[model samples]
Target chain A: MKLHELTIHEASDLLKKREISSQELTRAVLDRIESVEKKVDAYITIAGETAVKQAELADREISRGNISPLTGIPVSVKDLICTKGLRTTCASKILENFTPQYDAFVIKKLKKAGAVIVGKTNMDEFAMGSSTENSGMKTTRNPWDLTCIPGGSSGGSAAAVAADMCLGSLGSDTGGSIRQPASHCGVVGMKPTYGRVSRFGLVAFASSLDQIGPLAKDVLDCALLMNAIAGYDPADSTSVPEDVPDYTSFSNKGLSGMTIGIPKEYNETKGLDPEVSGAVKNAVKVIEDLGAKCVEITLPHTKYAVAAYYVIAPSEASSNLARYDGVKYGFRDKEKNSLIDMYRSTRTKGFGAEVQRRIILGTYSLSSGYYDAYYKKASQVRTLIMEDFKNAFKSCDLILSPVAPTPAFKIGEKIDDPLTMYLSDIFTLSANLAGIPGISVPCGFSSAGLPIGLQLIGRHFEEKKILTAAYNFEQATDFHKQKPEI
Target chain B: MKITKDEVVYTADLARLDLSENSINRFADQIGDILEYVDTLNSVDTEGITPTSHAIFLSNAFREDEVKESMGADKALANAPEKEDGNFIVPKVINL
Candidate 1:
């Protein structure tokens, strides 16, 4: 296999054996990106020169007998994560020229591990949409088919990994942003428990629901990335003081004693494509055949998830985004007369339609007269949803479901209808709401040849369990081995 | 659920965003649809359930109160759209 095509684990082994140097691997990946980037549009910034320099440094570290699993590995970061001196736009025009002076905690971790920073990937503006079409810059197409979306707001990261542009990627999930894209792109994406990873540098979406995790070609690679980034940091108050395990150690554990629950409500979801349902059922049978029991379960509050998420995510976004007024940083309008006029004009010009729509929705919901009816009500319902997951976990070790209601839809398919787009994330949002670990692994493909993903969710901080299950499924199947022909 | 153009304008004003007449109508219709869907939460009985502001049960995080170095003014003002000496420059707020 080419250097660009090697998973992080495979590439690390080759590097350790002195079979390939980090500079060569980084160069091969950069060459692949240059060849296919126009067709894939997977990155917002390609830090080619810096990546090679970093890889050379990693090679020197390797020669000195100092190395981590991620040392010399090339990884892409979603544009939402802060990377010092690199333009991190969140795919929004407001901060198109904004650059951070310091790295995010996760970026600091990746740098400390000697990982080569490849570039920043695109996303839905402010991570408010399910598809990257909301990106103010460029539309990131699914690698499998140029016409379909690599389900987003982490679309570019998933597409980058699927197209072999990067060994692995870091993506922040607010509500299925990571998993849904990984599903559509046919890779492994994990959204760890809410506080499992620090949020000190992630561009805030929904403060309570957002978490940064890894997207890679395989589950083991995802786990390796997790080990480097997870654990508590004093910088973020919400970060939990939980001990992170040796995630790579859980890779080969079989599913013999595990009891997987299939949420009956997921099967009954309206508009769920029959092919996706079939693929998930087949995956469950495969796991059962491997000596695990699959029992039907119910998260009774499933239907309320999307409803509650809309209110809660947007409410938080409105408050978090209020800092982009006109002075401190980002774009400012010169045509406005008054200070308030400048703020209004700058925002109106800087934000996209979807962002404007969400801001308005959030502002409306949080307004004094309506707060009790909308924001407060959503929070209360969020409690019920969390309780539902807590109760369901009592009967099973992990819950199995389809990551998304269907495989990726064509670009511009649901962009016009905001409600239709929001419903697409129905299957993946609850994991975020419940603050549990969830992963998407390639299961099968639609007749149209689009990738379908099977989701496994575990209780909070149970990433190792879900990773093990996903790795077992990956080992038993060749879905992850198949790559987009781009 | 039936958000009127007036309500959209009101909300936009509250958000400190300027919306054109065309956008006002569009936002009103779109936001009305989303609000209608979100209104389903009202149907569920949440009588005694405490509102969950966060997914995890995290208390106030405490840290050492000792002073530490912060980002220098040059770096802090790196991305400022307009700056003066060592401060971000904005529209005049006080007439006096």
Candidate 2:
């Protein structure tokens, strides 16, 4: 394979053997980005010079016999993750020119592992939408088909990996940003358990639900990226002090003795395309043939997950986004005559339509006399959703479903109808609400040549289980080996 | 569940946002639909079930009370649109 198309593990092996220089790999990736970035629009800022410098530094480190699994590998970062001295826009105009003063915890980990950051990827503005079309910066098209959306708000990262512009990338999941995009782009993405990775310096979308994770070419690359980023950090209070196992160590442990629960509710979801469901069903048959037991299970509260998520995510978003007033860093209104006018005008102009809609929804829900009816009721339903997963886990080791109801839709398909777009996230929202770890692995393709992903949800902090299952499935099938003809 | 333009304007004002007349009507219809969807939560039985503010419940992470080096004023205010005397400049809060 070409240097730009090499996975993290493959590139690291070649680097360790002194067969390929990091400079060559970085240059090849830069050339690839230069060639395909116009059609993909996967990146907001391209740090070509910085990547070359970092690759040179990595080469020197490798010569000294010091190398991590990610050393000398070029990776993209979602624009929301803070990189000191790098413009972190979150695909929003408010922070378009805002450069962070310090690296986020994950960025620090990636840098420490000697990974060269290629650039920051675009996303839905402030991660409020499911499609990257909501980005104030640019739209990231699915590399598989330029007319289709790369599922978002991590669309750019997935597209970059799919198009081989980067070896791997880091994307955050609030509802299903990371996994859904990965599914659409035909890549492997994992949303590690809540608090499995630190959130310090990650622009908050929904503080309670957001978790940073990895998207890569294959399962092992995802695991390698996960190992580098996952762990406790004193910088983020929500980061749990749990033991993170060596994810790569769990590979080759086949599906024997594992019980995969197929949620009945997932199949009953509205708008679930036949091709996507068929792909998931075929994935289950492959797992069952690999000596795993597939049994039907019911998550009775599944229907309420999307309803609960909208209320909770937006409410927390409104509260967390209150810091972006004109007085602080970010855009300001020069035409303001009064303090209130400044705040109102700056926010009105700085935020996009979807963002404004969410902020309004959140404010209305959290306002006096309405908090108990909206926020509290949603929280109560959230408890039920969590309990549903907790109960399902008692009967099975992992729950299997389709990552999204259908393969990627056209760019402007669901952009106009907010409610229709929200319903598209029905299958993936429950995992975030429950704070469980979930992964999206390529299963098959739709007849229209779009990729479909099979989701495997595990109990809280049971990433090793899901990773092992995904690794075995990948070994038994060639879905992940297939790449978009970008 | 049907939010009016007045409610949208009121909520936008509460959120410190100035919405145009077009956005007011648009947002009212959109948010009203979302609220109506979320109102489905009311049909479920949640009596005596405590609300979940966070999925992974953890107590406050307290640290030793000690002064340490923090971000310098320059770094903190580096991205500020307007700054003076190492402080972010904004419209006057008081009109005496």
Residue A56, model 1: Cα distance from true site in angstroms: 1.2
Per-prediction fnat: 0.93, 0.87
lDDT tens per residue, model 2, A1-486: 788988899999999999999999999999999999999999999999999999999999999999999999999999999999999999989998899999999999999999999999989999888889999999999999999999999999999999999999999999999999999999999999999999999999999999999999999999999999999998899999999899998858578899999988887788999999899889998999888999889999989999999999999999989999977788998898799999999998999999999999988889999999999999988898888888888899999999999899999999999999988888889999999999999999999899999899999899989999999999999988887887
Docking class of 1: high
Candidate 2 chain A, poorest ten consecutive residues by summed lDDT: A247-256
Q: Across residues A1-486, which tens digit of lDDT does each residue of candidate 1 receive?
A: 888999999999999998999999999999999999999999999999899999999999999988899999999999999999999999998999989888999999999999999999999999888989999999999999999999999999999999999999999999999999999999999999999999988989889899999999999999999999998999999999988899989846568889999888886799999999999989988899777889888899989999999999999999999988978888899887689999999999999999999999998999989999999999999899999999998999999999999899999999989999999999999999889989999999999999999999999889999988888899999999998898
Off by more than 4 A, model 2? none
- Enumerate the chain B TM-scores of all models: 0.92, 0.91
List the candidates' TM-scores in order.
0.99, 0.99
Q: Model-by-model lDDT, in order?
A: 0.93, 0.93
